[model samples]
Target: PFVPLRRITPTELATHGARKNASKIYWTVLEGRVYDITPYLPYHPGGEKELLRVAGKDGTKLFNLTHSWVNWDNMLRGCEVGILVSGNEMPG
Candidate 1:
C-alpha cells in the first residue's frame, strides 16, 4: 500500500531543507495544486530548469501537465513528507 505524499512549500525549503542534498526537496505547481517533485530532481528530463522555476517561489502555475503525466512515477516514489500550511510546514 502506498502512502499519500504530503504537501510542502518554498518557505519550508528556504528555512532548512535547502541546505543539504538529502534534505533538499523541491517542488512544482500544476493546475492550482502544489506537488512535491524533489525526488524527480535528479531524473528531471528538462534538467535543472524545471527545478529552478519554482526553486524559491510558489510554483502554482509553472507545472507542466506533460511532465506530470510522463514522470508520475517519480512523484510516487517517496513516502509522504508532509503538507505545508500557513505558518506550519509539517503534516499531521
Candidate 2:
C-alpha cells in the first residue's frame, strides 16, 4: 500500500489541530517530516498535553529540546504523513 505524501506549507500546517481547530487531527513537523501524532497521543509518556504543545506546528526544536536523545525518526516512522515544504517549494 502506498501512502500519499503531503507537501505542507507553514501556513497550512499551522491550522491542522491547534487549539481552535475543529479537525483535532494533531499533525506535527519533526526535522522537516510531517507526522499525524493524534493516534499516538495515548502512548506518549509525557501525556497528551505535552504533545498538544507541539501540535499543528514545527515540533523539531521542542522535541529536540527535551528529548534529543530519543530517536524520533524510528519511533515516528509509522506516523509519518509527509514533509514540511515552503509555499513556493512545489512547482505547478
Candidate 3:
C-alpha cells in the first residue's frame, strides 16, 4: 500500500540538512521526495559513508548516476518521509 506522505518546503529541507553529521535523523531528497535514510545507512551495500555524503541534501542525481535501474520506490517504500514541495506548489 502506498500511503500518501506530507509535503515539505525547501526551507524545511535545508534546516534538516544543516544539522549535518550531528543529526540523529538524516533526511535526503531524491526526485523531489524526502526520505529518512538513517536506518538504511548501516545496511547500505556501498557502505554508510557513501550515503552519508549526501545526507540532508538531494541525492537524486547521485542515485540516478549510480543506480538508475534500481527500483527506488520499492526499495525505499518504508523510509519515505514526505515530498519536497517547492515555494510555488501547494501542499496537500
Which of the numbered candidates is closest to the native, going by highest TM-score? 2
lDDT of 3 by residue, 1-92 (tens): 99678888877766666354455777889888898888888889988878876777898999888878988788888989998887677655
Candidates 1 and 2: which is better by TM-score? 2
lDDT for 57 (candidate 1):
48
> In angstroms, what RMSD does candidate 1 have relative to the true structure?
5.1
TM-scores of all predicted structures: 0.46, 0.86, 0.79
lDDT of 1 at 46: 80
Question: For this target, which candidate reaches the highest lDDT against the unseen true structure?
Answer: 2
Ranking by lDDT: 2, 3, 1
Q: Of the candidates numbered 1 and 3, which has the greater TM-score value?
A: 3
lDDT of each: 0.51, 0.86, 0.80
Clashes of each: 0, 0, 0
Candidate 2 wrongly placed segments (more than 4 Å) = 1-4, 89-92
Model 2: pairs clashing at backbone N, Cα or C within 3 Å: none
Q: Give RMSD to native, each candidate.
A: 5.1, 2.0, 2.7
Which clashing pairs does model 1 show? none
Candidate 3 pairs with clashing backbones? none
Better of 1 and 2 by lDDT: 2
